[model samples]
Target: MIEDHPQRYALVNELHARPFPSLTVPCQAVYLAVKEPIEAANRDRERDLAHLRALLARHGAAHPAPGATHHSAEIGRHVLKWESHTEFVTYSAFSAGLCERPFDPRGSEVFPTDWLGVAPGKRIAAVLIRVEPLPADMSEVVTKLEDWFVPESLAASWVLDEAAIIAGDFQIDPAGLMRFTVFARPGTGARRVGRIVQRLCEIETYRAMSMLGLGRARDLTGRLNALDPQLSSVVAALPDDHRAAEATLHELLELSAELESLATRHSFRFGATGAYEAIVNQRIDVLRETRFMGRQTFGEFMRRRYDPAMRTVKSAEHRLEQMAERAERAGELLSTRVDVERSAQNQKLLESMDRRADLALRLQHTVEGLSVVAISYYAVSLATYALLPVAEALHWPKSALTAVLVPVTFGAVWLMVRRIRRAMH
Candidate 1:
């Protein structure tokens, strides 16, 4: 056999990993999402595997293969589907039939409460969904919706080209569980109904997950407001005093550091929120919803409620980026101002040194003049003594000879000093 890439089989199997459950009509499902305080990207997969193993052990069912992120198991009278994601895990149990009373608690009792309490993470979302066979007339559907869900908050639609009618109030009840109902038309295959139900579950889950970013954005807004004015004040001072600019630069650096820290800490969550939001929208679009009872559909409800919160998150992310840019610009401007001030100071220093150098040159000229006069006097005295011996022979006066030699000696000394100065230069 030809060698293949090591991950080829695994990558191919991933497409079929989370297949839709073949759910029948006239049944109910319980969906629960669990999330940790920390992200699951670096979480311990062994812990999740252990939890799954524990649940499997309770039902004497086969364990899921190691490293599996999705599993479906039969637990006594119901079917359980578990999927692990980057930030959370979801558990969905589908039972064979509905309970006697509408919205009864028995349908959700498939998983023992004790087991749920010991799960690895806190519950993020809990939902109860009922799938029923559609009746002949639209009047019965309308009456059932009014009785089951809140009128003002109801979001109902005909999905899958009217192959199924789906409705939800999108509100939490006393049990802290959101409720949904799907009425599948006759001749709709089990797999198709299952796909519709799974899509609805995913829409709810991803919608709730995406809202986490909004909560973080709200928390950061106060800090951002406080930082804004401080940054503005620092930048306002940049053009004036260099000393003050230095101080302001320090503050700007601190602010920039804080902004970068915040960005690093929350970047993953913000990005994940965007991804999950897109998934929610994609699932809703695939539903191809049409209006029901002239009420708002799921897509409309998301637009009205969920869209605003996502906008807030985007606004927060953008605000952080703007503040960081402002800090960087302020630092650059302050640095330039400091450089100019240093250059001006250096110019003044050079001018002072020039004045001192000129004074030193004048003092050296005075010393040279004194040295010439002293050397000329000494040379003339020596010449007079030497010519005294010759005066007796030539009958010449020593004083006159000395007087003649005095001017010549002074000239000779001056010339020698000038020559030495030129050679040194």
Candidate 2:
């Protein structure tokens, strides 16, 4: 066989990892999403695997293969599909048959209480969906929907080219579950029904997941508000005195650190939120929704409720970025001020040094002149002492001798001093 890349087999097999369940009409399902802390990305995967195994063992079902991220198995009368995701794990239980009552809460009973209690993370989203045959009379379906969900908040749509009708208020009920109902036309394939149901469940789950970002954004608002004025004051103080600028720089450093910390803490959550929101929208789009009974469609409902929340999240992210940019600009300005001040101080220092150097040079010249005078006087006195005896022998005048000797001594001393100074240089 030709040599193959080590990951080729795994890479090719990944696409078929989570096969869509083949679900028939007159079926019910309970969908659950479990999430840990925002740091779920770094959480231990072994805990999740062990939890899955525990549930599988309870049902006497075969365990998922090692290193598997998704699994599907039959547990008693229901089908169980488990998918591990980046921040959470989802479990979907599909049981064939409808309850005697409309929107029965017991439909979720397929999942054991002990099993759910031992799930790896907190349940973030729990939904109950019912798939039924579309009645020949559309009015009867509309009446039932109104009875089930609040009319003002209900969103109903005919999806997949009117092959099915999907309706939900997207509200949590007293039972702590969001509800969705799908009415598929007769002769619709089981696989098609499953895809529709899965998309509907995904739309709800992802929408709720994305809203976590909005909650984070709201929590950050108060802290951000407090920081805003402090930052503004720092920027405003830039043009002030050196002391003020220095203080502002210190404050800016602290503010920058706080901003970075906040970003570091929430960056992953914000990014994950945006990704989940996009998936929610994409899932809805695939439904190919159309208006039902002149009521609000899924797209319209999201545009009203979900879009605003996402916008708030986006706004928060943008505000944080703007603050960081502002801090950076302020830091640059502070640095410039400090540099300019230092330059001015250096210039003054240089001027003072130049004056001191000039004074020292003048003193050196005066000292050289004094040294010449003193040397000449010493030389003239010594010569007079030696010449006194010689003058008597020659019978010459002492006054003339002394004057001539003084001039000659002065000249000699000046010449000698100049020669020494030149030699030293």
Candidate 3:
């Protein structure tokens, strides 16, 4: 028997998890995503599960297992799908009936007000999706769409080879929820309808999530503007500011630290923004949309309105990276200059020491010459005194005797001193 890997089953099940909801026509799905504004990714998953249980308890529904990332349950007349993500949680309720009025808040009755009040996080995206069979006259959809949405921002498209017509204005309705209408053509499978509904919800959810970076980008722009002038001044003064070399270096280090700090604080968000933006684009692309009745498709809508904000985020990210690189390069150049100056100063110090050593050696040689002359004078005096008696006995002159001994004594003393010096060496 073969032993399975520990995570084999778990990994396999993960792929099949969160299956698409099987919904027939005339169905409504109320979708909502919630997230903690700060430190969401590190939030306690148990609390999210608890919140999900609270909602399920309201309808007397069964609870999900512990550590579940997603769950689906029958709550009253609707099926509620709950999914937990890295930074947020989503709740989707599907019912097989639509309200008398299209995109009406009454269709979202599955989530009671009291249940939503105690939610653990803030609502990031909320949407009301209404699915129905396409009517015979396409002009009716146009008329109803104009009345239901702000026409200037409306995007209507035929997706999946005209199997479905989806429309939305991508704006918040008076009831504070995004509205999406999916009209499935005849013979469209229930699963296909459900997939389209899911995609619509995902598009809006990811779109809302991705836009969170816009505020960060704008704030970063302001900070960078303030820092630019300071950085420029420091760099410009480097050439003439020899006295302030250390001070300038210090200032450059502080500036570099700040830029690195900015990068650290926002790197995760910027990276996550790019990922979410890509997801939004991919989701829309999978729909394979074509323009309907001259209205803009989702892609075109994003290019005009959404792309600018995304571009702003990208521009800020690029500018930050470029500035950081410049700071690093400037630091390197300054460090090299500092090193060169230090080396030159050290060379001058070594030269001064050499001059002092030469003077000391000359003074020592002069002292040695004086010592030899003094010793010879004493030797001659002592010898003359001892030879005075002999000179008297031999009838020799004291001056002549002393003169002869003077040269001899001096020569002997010089030889002795030289020998001692050589021995010491």
Candidate 4:
């Protein structure tokens, strides 16, 4: 029957041409990638083949049919092509998981265990089962599956039933390709492949949950920014003695970097097949980086990382304003004290103080205006000083008195300053 189907030979040939990572299990590996309406050509298929090859390489596995005998089966109403070995299987999607099952199992006396073992080492059986729909709900499905394959009591020998295998599985890629994974225990015989499939399913479920968490985090970050317009101002206002605001900001930045790293590790790239693995990897990365603290500590870190950082910034600003007010009050108190101390030498002291205050205020105003005036004056003075020596060298009028020319020099300087300022405006 297999020899008569030339298309099966073509399929096997194609699978062998691609790179697939070889697993130690006597199981079949299945990877699914969505095909769009535009990609319904031979060229597109060739491209998809290349992409699948890359995905297998990333997972540290090789294509099973490379120079080896294999079997081919069309799955999901012929929407997916499956390449199978004695122990392993690989499924490639011709379309998204949208195919209808052509045949019903009512008349056929197929056992649940038989159906479970049909895919061999393929870790995506749970996903396929879910998509096909059982005659019962998930709970009933689990119950029926447990009846077929009993789980072991010992951790070392704990066998997976079909229901336990399917519970936590489902992954949707960015391009909307969903993959289910199953994990197998070491040396658990053929049934280990079922465990691998179950693990894949669970990983998918967690991936979806993590994505929800990420969305919530993003929303919270946006709300924090909206609630606090001037984080820097708030930070500046914090009490002079309190440095927690600055520390909080630094910690929040560090946390954001950590989250970004976690997301990168967890996120599946376009055209990648292993969404479940990516999510699991990302979750593990985050847990490892965060050091698996208590739930309260994790919550605190999140709050501090996002909202409290803004609060710290606001606190800093409030403190600054308070400091400014205190400084102004202190200056007034000092002035009153000085007035009380100088009663004996009142007239002399007051006159001296008054002159000094006037000079100080005038100096402040002069400094404020000095940049333009000083620059212009220095430029003109340099030119005039140079002219003084030149005039002497040329034996010009000695009565010119360069020092007396200060007023004229200042007038020219003022005009130049005005011109520059006007040009700037």
Candidate 5:
């Protein structure tokens, strides 16, 4: 799929195919894309002519013929020289111009903005070179060019497979494509060298855009909690679901996982680690907010609901205990009352039984007294009858005897009543 993309694949192939001049010897190059139609091309040509005239004037070569004078300008300590070639100009003078800038003395850094008329999709493209004279041994020139242009720190196995056409191990095809045999150089210093080589090799516009993208990513990540917020918003704003959120997230994660993938591919590093650290710090902020919410919710639950429920339970338990104690006390009081009532009832029953027993004893004593009186009266009647017989025989005082017997009977009845009372006692 990537190969089918003409723009991307063409660009990649061009980068690989082009001959990267040796930076150790100082060189400059530019890749241009022409955008205007035929009519606009003429205007672009006029503009280039005017720029050339300006260069000549600035370098004090204004009176020289168009093809005769090579304009040269002093930029800082280095001299920049511009001359016409068959199809392009040796623009290495621009680098010299950059070196002359006020801050050039600080380091060997190239600033693209210092160029006079460099822009994307311009009508023309060119590079320039000026180096210390090449070594007599052509092999040494090829070796040095390979080392200067391609740093081994980035690719340990990047080698030209074909045999060298040049004695110095450099080969060039008819299309102006040059290849060099390269080997890995391992050391801590190799990293710095690799970086320098990458900058030298890359197109200025592409490198600048990449830096802008990284800056944008950093700023966006800084404001948001997690990458999710940025991702979701971007996904939502998209025209369709063709840019799948899940897929995008996966891609993002993959990008993050292989932190050095792009750097490795470009043979350059783009502050990726620093950007990732910023993202991590943003995520930590999100985590802190989540933790705060959790703690707050739990605290509210405890304060407003759970604590009250527990207090209610405790109160209910206390009330139940009080009720149970009250019931127990009531039961004890009732039991005491019942015992007192039962004792009173028993005392009444005992008093009624004693009265009945006393009445029964009195009735029995009266019956015994009556029986004794009856017996004594019968004995007196028999004695009276015997006395009547004696009187008839004697023919004297029968009436007087009967009277005496009656009195005796009376006396005897009274005595018997007294005797029965004594026996009952």
Candidate 6:
């Protein structure tokens, strides 16, 4: 018998996880995404689970198993789908019906104000999707679109080989939720309708998440504005021969530290933004949209409005990196200059030490000469004293004897001192 890997089944089953909801036409879905404003990725998973439990309890619904990342349950007349993501949680409720008022927050009772008030995180995105069967006449959609969405920013398209006509303005309604309408062609499968709804929700969710970087980018721009001038001032002074290297080095280091802090603090947000942006684009691409009624498509809408904001984020990220690099390069150059100056000082110190050593050597020789002369004087005096008795017996002068001993004593002392100095050396 062959044994299976521990994760083999789980890994395979993951592909089937979060399958599209089987939704019939004339159904509507209310989707909400919640995320912690700070440290969302590392937020306590238990809190998210408890929040989900709270919602489930409201309808006397069975709770999902512990540690579940996604779940689906029947809550009254609606099917509630809950999913946990890296930094957020989403709750989607699907019901089969039409509301009397389209795109009105009060139209749905799935999310009560009190229940939403108790939610663990802030609402990152909310969407109301109304799916209807395609009408016999196309003008009905156009008429409803103008009434439902802001015409200046509307994006209407026929997607998935014209199986559905999807329209949205990418604007938040007065009720704080985005509105989308899906007109499914006749004979469209329930699963296909569900997929369309899901894609619409994702497009909004990821787009909102991606725009978070714009705020961070704005902050970085201000900081860069201040730091850039300080850095330039310091770098500009580097060429001045009168400017001190140490002072410039200190200023450069401060600039580098601030830039590093900025990069460290915002790296995750910028990276996440890029990933979310790519997902948004990819989701739209899969829709395979074509223009409907000479109106703009999702892609065109993003290119004009959304793309500029994304480009700003990219520009801010790039500018930060370049500033960091520039600071690093300047620091390196200043460090090298400081090292060269230290080397020059060390060289001069060594030269001074060599000159002192030479003078000391000359003084030492002079002291040795004086020492020999002093020692010779004492020796010669002692020799004269001993020879005085002989001089008296031979009737010779003491002065002559002293003079002869002086020459011999001085010569012997000088030779002895030379030998001693050589041995010491």
Best by TM-score: 6
Question: What are the per-residue Cα lDDT tens digits for candidate 6 across 1-425?
Answer: 99999999999999998999999989899999999888665788898899889888989999999999999999889999999998899999999988877865865568888888988889999999999999989999899999988999999999999999999998887788899999999999999999999999999999999999999999999999999999899888887779999999998998999999999999999999999999999999999999899999999999999999999999999999999999998999899999999999999999999999999999999999999999999999899888899988999898888878988999999999999988998
Cα lDDT tens digits, model 3, 167-275, are 9999998778999999899889999999999999999998888899999999999999999998998888779755567788899999999999999988988888899
Best candidate, lDDT-wise? 6
Query: Which segments of candidate 4 are over 4 A away from where they belong?
Result: 1-126, 129-188, 238-279, 282-425
Superposed model 2: Cα runs more than 4 Å off: 241-243, 373-413, 423-425
lDDT of each: 0.89, 0.89, 0.91, 0.38, 0.38, 0.93
Expressed as tens digits, the lDDT of each residue in 1-425 for candidate 5 is 33466588757865654232233322222222222222322334433445555544554553334443234445444334444322223333223222232122232222133334442123332222222323447566445544534332111111112111111111222322222211222221333222323322222212222233344334333433343344344334333435543444454444333333322332211233234234433332322221211123212322453334334433433433443343344334444544665687789988999999899889877876677667767867787787888877877586777777877877877786787668977
Candidate 1: residue 54 Cα off by (Å): 1.1
What pairs collide in candidate 1? none
**Which regions of candidate 5 deviate over 4 angstroms?**
1-321, 339-369, 385-402, 406-424
- Can you give the lDDT of residue 418 in candidate 2? 94
lDDT (Cα, tens digit) per residue for candidate 4, span 1-425: 43567687777877655332223332333333222222112223333344334434444445434433332333332223333322223453222232232112221111123433432222322233222222334455445333422223101111233222222112233323343322232344443343344334334343332233344344444544543344434334444334444443443344344444433432332112233335555433332222111112222333343334334433433433443344334334434444444564588888999999999979865774786567656866676767777778877664564555566777776777668767977
Whole-model lDDT, candidate 3?
A: 0.91
Count of clashing pairs, candidate 4: 42
lDDT against true structure, model 5: 0.38
TM-score, predicted candidate 1 vs. hidden true structure: 0.87
lDDT: which is higher, 2 or 5? 2
Residue pairs whose backbone atoms clash in candidate 2: none
Query: Superposing all C-alpha atoms, what RMSD in Å does each candidate have to the true structure?
Result: 3.3, 2.8, 2.8, 21.6, 37.5, 2.0
Q: How many collisions per candidate?
A: 0, 0, 0, 42, 5, 0
Task: State the lDDT at 67 in candidate 3.
Answer: 93
For model 1, the superposed segments whose C-alpha errors exceed 4 Å read 241-243, 360-424
Candidate 6: what lDDT?
A: 0.93
Instruction: Give the TM-score ranking, best first.
Output: 6, 3, 2, 1, 5, 4
